[model samples]
Each structure stands twice: as structure tokens, then as C-alpha cells.
Target chain A: MPQKNTLIYSNWWKYAGAALVLYSLIGGLLFVNPNNLLFLDETVRNLNYHVPMWFAMISLLCISVANSIMYLKTFNPKFDIIASKSAEVAVFFGIMGLATGSFWAKFSWGTWWTTDYKLNGAAIGELIYFAYLILRNSVEEQNKKARLSAVYSIFAFPLFIVFIIVLPKLASNSMHPGSGDTVGFNKYPLNNNLRMTFYPAILGWIAISWWITTLLIRIENLKSIENTDEN
Target chain B: MLLGLVSHNMFAQTTENPFYSNGKIYVVVAVISIIFTGIIIFLIRIDRKLKKTEKEINKKNQHKD
Candidate 1:
């Protein structure tokens, strides 16, 4: 029903995403880790599953905020729908990322939750978006709801970036990778084995995120159509 | 004796992979299963939503008629 030519709505991408994710799931299990790093050991395979989740979450959040900005500029209700639904999917993936990370951490760090900067930052970012959802539901008027949430989304995104990306790097003795004094995963470049699985997983997750958001948009459209029919 | 032979063959096959020695392969299986389960649940939720929407629209059409 959209007049615009957006790549997100395409069926081919959905198929491709499903295929890539299936491939990654199989590969992540079968492909042998080259170095077999310590502490991580066999759980290093979780990198394909756990890390791509954060990548998908960030990508969805980026799409959500971009649509929010577009809504502000054009004031289109459709953009509002896209923005909100994308954020909803983003939150879903973020929670999954946290849960998987916690599971991984329990084995790797010997704790389910840590006071690490990155962990706390990710928690705060998730809370900020949860607040954004609460703020949206509080308003009844359509335009006002969209405008306020759009503004809030734009404001929160930069804080999210700072929390998840910047603050972790600044703190010393943080538990996560790429933090101060820690080499992180980047210490060893992903060899062909890891790269083959990793890249496909990222694409698959992003595609799945897009597929879910579009389904949500379609549902919203149906509701709106029903409302108009009643009128 | 037959049961023991089957169990021994299973164990031998599993032990063939060096990665299986650490019991880490099960972790990989668990993670993949969790992801697949999550996706299945999501699909079911969407299907439920679509069915509800269809019923509502059909009821509205009947009322109009």
C-alpha cells in the first residue's frame, strides 16, 4: 500500500534473510574455531548467535530513529507507524541480546550480571527506550503522540550511542571487549571460518527485523482501515 | 548386549569430533534451539494477530451488509 519504494518491504529480502540465518545456525555449530581461545573455549561459538543480536538491535534502533526523523520532517502518520514498530522490534532483540549475553557471561565471567560499564550502559539504553514506549502510550491524540515520541526518540538515540559505545571505552577495568586496557574480540581478526558465519548471521537478523516490522505496519494499517470503514 | 552396542556406537560417533570432548557442542545446540524457538514464537504471534484482524474485518463486512 505504500507509495514509496523501500527495500524493507520486499519479499525476496525476507527469503534471503531466512536462508542466511539458517545457514549461519548450521555453520556456527559445525565450523571449527581456528584459535579456540581460552576462557571462551567452545562457548566462543556463541559469538555468532549473541553478538549478531546486538548488531540486529542496533540496526533496528537506527531504522526506528531514522523513521522518527522522517516523521518530524514530513509529519506522516505512516512514518510514525514505521518508527514505533521498528523500535518495538529493536526492544525485542535488545532483550534477547541481554538474556543471551547474561547466559554467556555466567559461563565466561562466572556471573550472571556484572557491574561492567558496557552492561550498565546497555541496561540504561533499554530503559530509555522502554520509557519512550511509556511516553507514547500516555498520549491519546494521533499527531501529538507522534510528534512527542519522535522528538523523544531523536533525543534518546544520541544518549543510547554514548551509553553503549562511548562510556564503555572511557572506563578502566571494564569487563567487555574494546573497553579500556582490554583487547576485546578484535584482538584476533575473524578468520574465514568465523567471517563466513558471522556476516550471514548479521544479514539474516537484520532481515528478520525488517520482516517483523513490516508485519506490524501491516497490522496497524488493517486497524486503521477498519476504523475508517466504521466512520 | 544390543542396547550396549548401540550406546557404544553413539558415544564413539560423538567422540569423533574433538570439540565434543569439552561438551561445548551441546551449548551450541542449545543456543541455536533457543533462537529457533524465539523465531517460531514470533511467527505464531503474528499469525494470531492476522487471524484476529481477519475476523474483525469479516464481522464488519457482515454488519455493513
Candidate 2:
């Protein structure tokens, strides 16, 4: 279990997050979308669902990378456990983002997959993280595994950002909004009603993602503590 | 208000696309349902993890006894 004073041990935020998520679902569906984009009419509501996955992923991965840095500085096994578990949750969110994006593309772009820079970049970025997990598993010695994985995570975070955010913008064409020529939802697509749900949705999803990561970390702690006791 | 009128007009208008069917409201339902299902699946995973941990703890306690 996390320290009693820690956010992970606190129950209020988890309940708040659940309430916000439920509100977002109902309000997201009910909110009026004023923008009448050609292909993305009613599906504009997907903004509340799809975009938040990436936001949650990025937030959790930021935590993961921060913990990795902490581990490198202190060589603490606890930090390494936190780093790995958060990364695992972040990858789960990234996969959700990819799956939802693919489904959205099928309707709007008229294809399940496309040659677009952002889409390919997102996929490749996930593959890099997958390699990070594989890298963690291949090494056996506890400290060595933690040290190596932390270093890999530190190096990979920048590359992941470049692949998902930077490369998409640098490329001449991208189907995704806020990249290439297409303006973000803030410019025109999102009106006040949509914003009411959108911001809360992102916050809520990120909160839930962190909650899940903390749970995983607790489980890891329990198992590792048991191992130490037996040894 | 003007915003109300615009939204009413928005809902009044309909298109032939599948997304626009039932004033495109069902699309929102579908998206919400998918997300709900995903959350439920995550809950199930957490439950399984808790169960495994409980079993481990029980085994350790038995050994101590």
C-alpha cells in the first residue's frame, strides 16, 4: 500500500474522477456540436472520448519518465517499480488511443489505416514502448533490470514525444487535427458547450489512469515485499 | 437565445450518413458504450489482481502457521 498521506491512498480523488467521467459521458453525448465539418459531423463528439486517451497516456508516461529519472538519481528500487507500473498503464492508454483513433478514421477518413504521418508516428511510438517492456523483462538481476530499464525509459521518452507530437507536425501532411495544416478543435470545432465536457473528460481520464497505475504499483510492492521477507 | 435557436436548427437538420441517423445521437451512445465497456474490463482486471494478491497472502500466512 502507498503511504497513508499519499494521493494514491486518498479516496476522494478517485470518487471525484469517477463522477467527472460519468458526467462527461452523459454531457458529452448531450452537448451540442455547432461545427458542421464535412465528414466529422456528429462524430465530433468522439473528441470527448478519443482525444482524452492520448492526454491520459501522455500524463501517465510523464509520471513514468519522472520516476525513472528519480530512480537514476537515488537508485531506489521503489522508484523503479513506480516507473515500470506507470509505464505499463501509459502503454495501455496509448493502445486505447490507437484503437479509438483507428475506429474514428474508418468513419471519417474512409480507411481503417492510412499512410498519414501522425497515425504511423503514433503506432511506431507505441512499438518503441513495447520494446521498453521487452527490455525490462529480458534482464534478470533486480538492480540491473531496474537501472537498465530506467535508462531506456529516460532515452525513450524524448523519442516517443518526437514520434507522436513533433514528427507529425514536421511532416507536410497529417490527417490528425492540431498537426500539419489542420487547426486544433479550439479554433472552431469546440464551442462552449463542448468545452464544458471536453476539459473535464481529459482530467477525469488522467485521474483514472493514475489511479490504475497506483493500484498496479501497490500489487508490485506487495509481491516484492513478500519476496524480500521470504529471502 | 440565439444559441438555442442555432442548436435547435442543428438538430432539425439530418443527413443520410450512418453517423447522422437518429440525428446522429446514437453515435454518441455507441462511443459512450465502448468507453464504458473498456472501463468495466479494466475493473475486472483489477479484481483479478486483487484476487491473486489475496491468494498469495493466504499462502504466506499458511506457511507461517
Candidate 3:
């Protein structure tokens, strides 16, 4: 278990996160967009809810990969548990990003799914992580599973970055903003008014996600501790 | 026919659907609701697991006593 003094065990950040999210929820809807977005209309407010999911996913997965590296160096089962739990939360956020993105696309792009580079790239990236989970389940030995999945995660992170972040930028005709010829939403659609909520929304979402990850980590730690006691 | 009604609802983006009305403010409400619901469900699952863990701990303590 993380010591009581440790930041993860601290309760302040969770409350702060909840407060910021509440502020964003009210501010996101109440704040008027200074610019009229073509094809987005009122759905422009989805920026506060949808965009944050990807940010939180990337942050959590980065933590997961970092823990995997730590596991490799120290051979600590704790690090392996943290890495897997982080990946689990990251995958959940990724799915939420996809679902919300699909809904947003249906309104703006006139389709639920699209052939856009970013869309396809995100889908493929999600599948790779799903495969990682399946690979872990396939191995029975604890140490071997940890070692193998740690190595896999080390490799998977780079591939995930390439698919979800890099390839889209390289694709010339990609419809996603910030990829290809299109500028990000920050360039035109997001005015100072929207930024007020957008930045906090991202921070709040990341904090909330980390809160959940820590809870899962504590649960896993408790389970292991109990098993050790039994034996 | 029911098929025609379903197709019209899907293809026509019917305003009769409550979410499409009132300048579509309800869409924002729907998005917010979905996010909140997802978070609550996650917390509920965690709560159940924690409860089970607590019960096990209590049983172990009783056995020790």
C-alpha cells in the first residue's frame, strides 16, 4: 500500500478534480462561443467533454508505459500491477474518446464512422491495447506474464503514439483538425471564452482519471497483500 | 409501416426527437449525462469490489480472534 503521506493516498486532488469538473460542466454549457463554427453548431461544446478523454488517455498510458519500464529495471510485481491497471483505465478512456468522437462525427461529418486517417488510426491503436490484455491473460506464470507484457507495453507505446499521433499528421488528406492541412480547433473555433473551460476541462479529466487508476492500484495491492497473508 | 417510421427517424434527423429540439441544447445535456453516468458506473463497480475486500478482511480478523 502507498503510504498515507504519499500523494496518491491524499484525498485533496480528488475533490479538486470533482470541483473543476463541476465548474466545467456548468461553464461549458453556459459560456457562449464567440465564433460560429461551421458544421459543429451547438455541438461545439463537446470540446470540453470529448477532447479531454484523449488527453487523459494519453497521460494515463504514458504513466502505464513508464511503470512497465520501472518493472523491467526493478522486477517489482507492484510496478507490473500498476502498469496493467493504468492500461486498463487508459483503454477505458480511449473507448470513451471513440464513442464521443463517433457521436460528434455523425453530427458534423454526416457519418458515424469515417475513413479519416485519425479515426482509423485511433481504432487500430485501441485494438493493439486490447491485444496486450489478451496476451497477458494467455500467460499463466506471474513473473513470466509480467516480463512479457512489460516488454510488449514498451513496444506498444511507441506504436500507439505513431498510429494515434504521428501517422495522422503525415497523412495529406486527413480530415481531423491538427492533421494534414487543417489547423487545430484552437486556431479558429476556440476563442478565449472557450479556452477558459477547455484548459481546466483537460486538467480536471486527467486528475479524475488518475484518481480512478490509484483506486484500482490500491485494490490490486490489497488483494495481493491478502493472498500473501493467507499463504 | 414501422420500418418507414424508423427509417425516417434515422435519416431525416427528426426534430421530434427531444434531443433535436430547443436549439439542440439537449444534445449538450445528453453528452454531459453520458459522461456522468459512465463515471458513476465506474465508481459503483469499484465500491462493490471494495465492499467484498472489506468483508474478507473482517472474516480474517474474526478468525484470528
Candidate 4:
């Protein structure tokens, strides 16, 4: 068995995550929306759910890349396990974000998907991480796989940033907020009630992602132990 | 004074949405709540399965020892 001190997990944040998300769910639906917004209507409530998924995705990807860097520096398999699991959770959130955004757009923009820069950027960013998963699977040796993927993650993360953040701003016809003529959340501005719920929703999602990743890492550790025993 | 301010504000803002007034918004809320509940339950199930697997592995290790 591994040392007890080595395996540090906290239950407090897990409960907090669940509670915050519950609060957000209740507050997000019932809270008073600011009156008279063009196109968005009642669907502006999606901001509490959809926007936060992207925030959680970005946060997870940052953790993934940070772990990748740590793996390179320390050559620890544990860090690589975490890095890979974080990316997996990030991809899960990215897909959720895309689905939610597409649903929102269908109502607001009158289409499921757009040819806009932000949409394409988000698609490409998701594709890059998907390709990272494929790269991991293709490698035969574990150490070589970890090393190569860590390098790829470190390099690709900046390009991913450019796709989602930088490119949208540069493009003229982008429909997402803070780009072109589009008014963002700032222009409409979340009321005090919405802000209270929204911030907690982001925290809740990040905590949930962390919980899932830790569970995955623990499973992998158990599998490794089983493999070593068989050998 | 606070009661006067509250009454004044209530009269001042006459925002109208048919869905909210008719209680249809609660339907939407119910649907969202169900979806969120389902996802959380699924996560909890997965966590339980992992815990079971860990326990089985620990048992096997103890048997080997």
C-alpha cells in the first residue's frame, strides 16, 4: 500500500461543490433577469449554465497543462496520470459547453452552429485536445507516451488559447460577446442576485471536475497496483 | 420608510412576461433540475463503483500477503 500522507484527498470541497451547484440551479432559474434584451429573451438564463461550462473547461485545461509541465520537471508518473485525467475532464466540459451553446444559439441566432470565428475556434480547440487523446493512445511505451504527450500539451495549450480567446477578438464578424459589435455580459450586466449564483456555479464546476479527475487517478493507481502484483 | 420604498419600486417596474405569470417558468425549472439531478446521480454511481473496485483490490492484496 502507498503511504497515507502521499494520498491527500479532501471531502469538504466535494460537498461544497455539490451545494454550490444546487444553489446555482435554483437561483439561476428563479432570479430576475434584466428586462429588454434583444434575441436572448428567457434563454439569457443559459448564461448561468453555458458560460460557466466554458469557464470550467478553461480552468481544467489550465490544470492539465500545469500538471504536464510538472511531469516534465519531476518525471513523475502521478503527475502524468493527473494531467491526462484533467484533459479528459476538460474535453467532457468542452463538449457540454458546445452542446449548451448550440442549444442557446438555435433559439437566439436561429441556427444550431454558426460559421463565426468563435464557434470555429472552439471547435478547433476541442479537436486539438481530441488529437492529444489520440496521440496518447497511439504510443506503445508508457514513459515515451507520457513524455511526448506532456510536450504536446505544453505546446498546444497556447494555440488552444489563441483559437478560443485571441482569434475571436481579431475577427470582425464574430457573434460572441466582447467581440465586434456584440454586447457581452458586461453590457447587459448580471444583477447582484445573478452574480451571486454565477460565481458559485463556476467554483462548483471546477470542484466537480477536480473530484472526477481524482477518482480517475485513484482508479488508475489501483490498476497499476494490480498489474505490478501480477508481474 | 423601507416599506414605502418597496411599494414604490413595485409600482414603478411593470415588467411583463406571460410565461412567468402563468407559472410555465416552473416547468422549465423542473426540467433543468431533473437533468442536473440525473448527472449528479450518475457521478455518484461512478464513484461508488470505483470504491468497490478499490476494496476488491485491497482484499486481493491482503490474501496474497
Question: RMSD to the native, candidate 3?
Answer: 9.0
Select the stronger candidate by DockQ from 1 and 4: 4
On TM-score, the leading prediction is 4
Residue-level lDDT for A113 in candidate 1: 98
True contacts kept of 4: 0.37
Task: Point out the worst 10-residue segment of candidate 2 chain B by lDDT.
Answer: B12-21
lDDT tens digits, residue span A1-231, model 1: 235345643467876887788778877776645344666776877878998888888998899999999999999888899899999888999999999999999998999999999899999999999999999999999899999999999999999989988999998878777886677775776542567678899999898878887888878867776776779
With a 3 Å backbone cut-off (N, CA, C), the pairs that clash in candidate 3 are none
Given candidate 4, what's the lDDT at residue A162?
Answer: 96
| Candidate 4 Cα misplacement greater than 4 A, ranges | A3-8, A189-193, B1-15, B55-65
TM-score of 2: 0.81
> What DockQ would you assign to candidate 2?
0.20
Cα RMSD for candidate 2?
4.6
- Can you rank all candidates by DockQ, best first? 4, 2, 1, 3
Interface RMSD of each: 6.1, 5.0, 10.0, 3.9
TM-score of chain A of each: 0.94, 0.95, 0.95, 0.93
- iRMSD value for model 3: 10.0
TM-score of each model, in listed order: 0.80, 0.81, 0.80, 0.86
The lowest-lDDT stretch of 10 consecutive residues in candidate 3 chain B is B10-19
Assess each prediction's global lDDT (C-alpha) against the native: 0.81, 0.81, 0.81, 0.81
Fraction of the real A/B interface contacts present in each candidate? Answer: 0.15, 0.15, 0.07, 0.37
- lDDT, residue B8, model 2: 62
Give the range of the ten consecutive residues with the poorest summed lDDT in model 3 chain A. Answer: A1-10
Query: What does the i-RMS of model 2 come to?
Result: 5.0
